[model samples]
Target: MQRYFVTPAGLTETEVVLEGDDARHLATVMRAKAGDPFVACDGEGTEYVAEAAEVSPGRVVGRIVQRRASASEMRWRVTVAQSLPKGDKLETVIQKGTEAGAYAFQPFLSRRTVVQYDDRKEAKRVERWRKIAKEAAEQAHRGRVPEVGAVASWKALLAGFAEYDAVWLCYEEEGRAGVGLKPVLRAFGSSLGEGETPNLLLVVGPEGGFAPEEAEQAIAAGAACVGLGRRILRTETAALVALAAIGYESGEMGG
Candidate 1:
């Protein structure tokens, strides 16, 4: 079934209004008609199976059939803090991470980061990233879109350390003794009580990876350094691997 993200106001007591782009997509692109049932999510992370009550150029209405827990969201809320990569790699990270069940993407500029955001175009860039996240969430059947944070300097990101229940620093130079992803997640899982959810923060470096001093600073800030494996992963690959590992640990995917 096609899934779309609608505002809380869009999902009324018994109905959902497929407005603007969603309406057009449903009526013209998907050829949706009245009585066709589909799934949709509201702003509050509630999923509903609804039957189309009306389909037109400007609007497609769906009557709510049932409300249930969102299957797309992971049990733990994870925020991926990635060092800005060159080109449009950050976009790819946000898109894939959203599908992988990340709750937010925080792009930071590291010592090795080469991408310079043009001050005049910063707003537009952020907007495009947000749009990508929303569309990706809809495509992935996510209950809500992952937030794409504005690009920030490494120091700015470190200042928000207290917000996360646990922080994993994906630094490659941590050596053989570097904590493994499995153990890191296992520790987190053990800490949480049954039915408890914790917000996790993951830090991934850019194309050039983090400098020793940067890794030091993160470790000093209480972020646990966790290595992916013996193999080297590209900047874009690190977040995906981390998300997959988290999913496996959380039982969102098979262990």
Candidate 2:
């Protein structure tokens, strides 16, 4: 079934009102009419089976048939804190990252970051990134939209390490750092309760990769600095690989 994310306020006792861009898409793009069925999510883990009851100039109303838990979201929450890369790399990162099951994305300004953003530019970038994430989520059948947050400095990101259960930094220079992500992942899995959820924060550097001192700073902030593998991956590729690994390791992929 087709699915769209809606706000909780848009949902009433027996119906959901689709407005704004969604309405525009349904009215003009999709040509949706009364009696057409579709799924709607509140982006807070609730999914509604609905059928169009009314279609208007600026809105489409759907009467709810059922409400259920969202199965599209991963059991583990993975947040990607990526260093700003040049060009449209961040857009690709947000799009693909959402499909790979990232819960949130934080764009950071690292020592070797090529893209520089002032306050005004950062806000604009964040808005654009968020739109990409939303579209990606819809395409990926995700029940919730991954949040694209404001840009942060490396130091600011490090200070927030305590919020995550597991923090990982993909550093090329960490090959000989004596830390392997496998063991850490195993230990994390072993410590979890029967149905306990994992909260992971993955830190990916920019095109130039993390500076030696920056890697040290991440390590000091309780993040395990581990190598992706022998051949280095691009900034966007690294985060996708890490997120996929986390999903598979956390049993999110399959039995």
Candidate 3:
């Protein structure tokens, strides 16, 4: 069944009203009509099996048939703090990162960051990124839409390190001494007792990677400077890789 993320207000009294772009997509793109079945999620881990009760000019009303907890979301919470990359790469990162089960995304401006965002443009950019995350979450059957936060500077990013249980910075210059991300992950796993939720934050740098001084600063801010193996991955690819690794280590993938 096709899945969509609806606001809690959109879902009420056993019916979900799909309006805005979603309704347009269903009416024109998907050609959905009355009786067609789909899934509507509240973006709070609840999935409702629904059928089209009414289709109109600008809306599609779905009557809920059944409701259940969402299965696509991972038990662990992982946030990716990515340095803003140039062009459409941020879109790709938002999409893939949502599918990989990221809880939130924070775009940071690093010392080596090539792209600069002014206050006005930054708001527009965050809105666009959030839309991407929403669509991606719906498509991937994610229980919740990953949040796209406002752009942060390196200092701001480092200052927020204490909020997460574990923080890993993907650094290119780090050698074999830092190559073992899995061991640290295992140690983190051991530290968690049963029923404890894992909270991980991954920081990926820009195309130019993190500056030496910046990396040192991040390490001092309680982030582990970890290497993602030998080959250098693109900024977008690096975030996805870290998300996947964290998901696997947290048993979202097979244990």
**TM-score for each predicted model, relative to the true structure:** 0.94, 0.95, 0.95
Model 1 stretches with alpha carbons more than 4 Å out: 175-178
Q: How much is the lDDT of residue 252 in candidate 2?
A: 87
Worst 10 residues of 3 by lDDT: 173-182
Model 1 / residue 180 / CA error / Å: 2.1
Q: lDDT by residue for model 3 over 7-73, one digit each (tens)? A: 8778897899899898888878888989999888888888899999998758999999999998888
- Where is model 1 poorest over a 10-residue stretch in terms of lDDT? 171-180
- Estimate, for each residue in 119-152, the C-alpha lDDT of model 1 and write its tens digit: 6988898999999999999888898888888888
Every candidate's lDDT: 0.87, 0.87, 0.87
User: For candidate 3, what is the lDDT?
Assistant: 0.87
Over the full model, what C-alpha lDDT does candidate 1 score relative to the true structure? 0.87
The candidate 2 region of ten consecutive residues with least summed lDDT is: 173-182
Instruction: Report residue 223 deviation for candidate 3 (angstroms).
Output: 1.0
Off by over 4 Å in 2: 176-180
- Candidate 1: deviation at residue 224, Å? 1.1
Candidate 1 RMSD computed on C-alpha atoms after optimal superposition onto the true structure = 1.6
